[model samples]
Target chain A: MSGTFNDVIQIIYLAAASCFILGLHLMNNPATARRGNQVSIAGMIAAILATGAIVIHDGLITTTGWIVLLAGIGVGSGLGLYTARTVKMTAMPQLVSVFNAVGGGAAALVGIRDYSTLGSHVAAATSVTTLLDVIIGSVTFSGSVIAAGKLQGIITTAPVTFPGARIVNMLLAAVTLGFGGYMIASPSLAALGVVIAAALVFGVSMVMPIGGADMPVVISLLNAFTGTAVAMAGFVIHNTGLIIAGALVGASGGILTKLMADAMNRSIGNIMIGGFGSGDTAAAIAGPAGAGVQSIAADDAAIQLAYAAKVIIVPGYGLAAAQAQHEVAALADLLEARGVDVSYAIHPVAGRMPGHMNVLLAEANVPYPLLKEMDEVNPEFARTDVALVIGANDVTNPAARRPGTAISGMPILDVDQAKSIIVIKRSMGHGYAGIDNELYANPKTSMFFADAKKGLAELTASVKTLVG
Target chain B: MTLLTDFIIFVLSLWVGFEVISKVPATLHTPLMSAANSIHGIVLAGAILIAASANSLIGYILAFLAAAFAAMNVVGGYVVTGRMLKMFKRRTVPASAQAPAVNAGQNGGKSA
Candidate 1:
């Protein structure tokens, strides 16, 4: 391509990058978030078109290369569009995981191809970046697949571990980095191949032992890995656009990971270690506080809900699993008809991912303003007349406030403080944390035993029957 | 000097990303993530460039795969993020007025 044309392309890329930054900025608020996304798409389209123009103007592409390149774009776009359109809001987390896999794999390939072509002519900077790219990208690719598999139940959601799991993780880490170091010095294909293989295994081992509840943090971390790998790929290819976009995602994703982990009161280092058996110790330390629980019938629970001046509903993944979001919304509608101030208290890590419960509720046409974050909603619980918990367990557990429990230090919705509590549950099974929820045993708490959908439906009917 | 400029750009961009994205509320984490995912699809440009110079069999194969992956990352990423954000919009803005910023009502209605 000519110098003028390349300069124009670079300018175009600069404008697109600005769009991305501004788009993200606009995402800071719900009002402008959609506009932010559109702005970003405009930038991406410009960048893609500019790149395509470059390829055509360069006139060096073989006929076969063009066919493969164009066909690949067409196929990938078709799949991406199809998957994105068809995926349910509840399944967005895993879909994001799969997309992370694709992005990571693609970034790693960029590094791999560049290194293969370089042979021994690789500069120190390029070699280091390529090695880093391959390691991080391959890890994200394989790790995300395992995450998606776990979510979809293709792999066990239970923390899978062997006796030497930590030791194996250490060995995999050692091999990946040790071989990666050698490749940086020698620049050989075999060493690079070994590094990729080791990293892939490490990704699998690292994720398998992580309990399903911690997936939001893991997914955010992998999203960062995807960005970092692409940035490294940018270094290998000397592309400024790649570096900027990659670095932005890398840093922002890192911040989001920290924010979510902090919200759950989990340490990043602990999550990254993801070693097994901590639950046993935490369980032992916490001891048994749950007993003498009270069970309430649908009519009784509905009585409390119908007559309460203020009610706060706490939902979790169980609610989504039961597809009871709509039912809950209907129940709330009935409560509101009786002059109850019904709103939702959404714990950050309530569902499998951050904002998951909110998305599900919104999809059910729950008013956005009626939904509130933990900080904003916690104090309101003290003034609440009824705390109706449907299918949510760990996030509302009073035990989280005390030390030594599996979920100690975690921030929970203050449902225990409400004057009366009605819990809708299928059974007395332990929550995802494997610790019995302490709130259940509270004198004011009553477990209304039924599936969230069934229980909520019955409550809605009961409220209509009793109050109508 | 060129390398120095690239490094500077990378550092500044990282700072910019952190500053912008840190302000996003937890309610929009999923959309913010998918949006950022689309941004990194700049790798599609790199893949396209490589495809242009690809000569041998192995080069062509690598370019093809990278292009496919990058294309998916670019196209699907924007589309999904847009869908989720559209749902958010339905609530944030009153149902009376739709924002003109995203007029692709055909595509936006899928996930909404």
Candidate 2:
């Protein structure tokens, strides 16, 4: 290849990286986020094309290699497109976790192939990157798959722990790092293999003990790992495009992870050590604990909503589980018709992922402006005539206000401040933290025990039929 | 490129990313995350380049898997992220006369 042509190819990679950065910049606002995705798609296409050009120019590939490459592309793109088209909005987080699995898995393979092909003949610097690449990539791969499985109900959403789980986790880390160090010093094929094996197991173990409620943080952390692994692969193969793109994602995922953990008022380390309650509510209700609770009928709840000057709806994972975004949105629409001000209060970690509740609501044709974030919507709860909490538990629990409790220090929706609070829940079943929601017992609150889908639908109906 | 050059590039990109992403609103977190997930799919390029030089049986197998996985990540990540971002729209509610019709005759509320 001519020097200028090679430089041009390099320039294409740079342009592609710039597009990714620009795309992320545009994503800060909702209106431009879609366009941002488009710009990113363009960047990916250009980068892929340039890579194809490089392969053709090098002409090192055999006929078998070409066949393998084409076949991979065909199968991969077809599967990807199929999932992207068919996935339910509720399963978006799982799909992203699956994507992380593949990205991390692929990056690990790159490092593995490079190491085995070169062996001890490789430079120490390159070997260091490859070891790091293989470790992070392999761990991200298996961990993300577990995360996806948990989210998809294939694996239990509850924390899965064993005796000395922490000790076992420590042992795995030691093996992975120890083997990685050995591989760097001597650059042995066996050492690299051990690192890969240990890291894969480490990944699975790392995510296994995590409860479902912490998925938002876990997924983001795994995503950051995936990016860092890709960057290591970039360093291994000396690709500037991979380095820039990987670093950008790594940093962004890091920030998002911090945001999610903060939303739950848990340290990242505390969340990662596992044994926090699972993501779903599975605890049996303590029958006697229901004392002093005010349970409202559909008409009563609807009357409160219909007469309210302002209604704030707080939605959580159960709302998504019951597929009630549309129901809730329709309820809001009905109340708005009667001159009631209605908006959704979205907790950052409300669902399985950050900002996931907003997406679910948006799919139901709820306007973007009506989905207010925690800090922005909390103060408004005071002026709200009725705070209708649909399937939300932890985020609205008043227990988060005080220290020593599981959710203490977690910022909760000020639903308790509303003139009237109605909780739409299945029962007094505990939520993700396995603790009772103190908000349900608040003097201003009433429990409307029902499935979120049916409850929201009923509330909307009652508002239409019973409200004057 | 030298290790130092690569580190420089990585650090600079991280800084650029932090500056851009630091102030993102809560509502865009999911889309932002999905987008960032897709961006790292640039590893697809490295996977393809490796396949270009693969010679042995093991090499071909690894290359095949890498390329396939990377392509899946790139295509799947972007497509899903796009599908999500597309939903973050501001839809104008219909006239109030039609609102009641949307929720009429819904089932009674309360746990069975």
**Model 1 regions lying over 4 Å from their true place:** A275-290, B89-112
Tens-digit lDDT track of model 2 for A270-372:
9999888765757656542476788889998999889889989889888999999899988998899899999999998888887888888888988887889
What TM-score should be assigned to candidate 1? 0.93
TM-scores for every predicted model: 0.93, 0.95
**At residue A286, what lDDT does model 1 achieve?**
35
**Residue range A1-468, candidate 1, lDDT tens digits:** 578998998899899899999998888777688888889989988888888888888788889989989988998899899988999988888988888888888999888888888878767876888888889989999999999998777887767877988899999999999998899788898998899999999999989988777888888899999999888888877788889999999986798788778877878888876653232112322322346988889888888888889999988777998889989989887787778898898888877766788778877877666888888899998899899888778889889888899888888889999999988877777776777888889899998888789889999999899989
Each model's TM-score for chain A is 0.95, 0.97
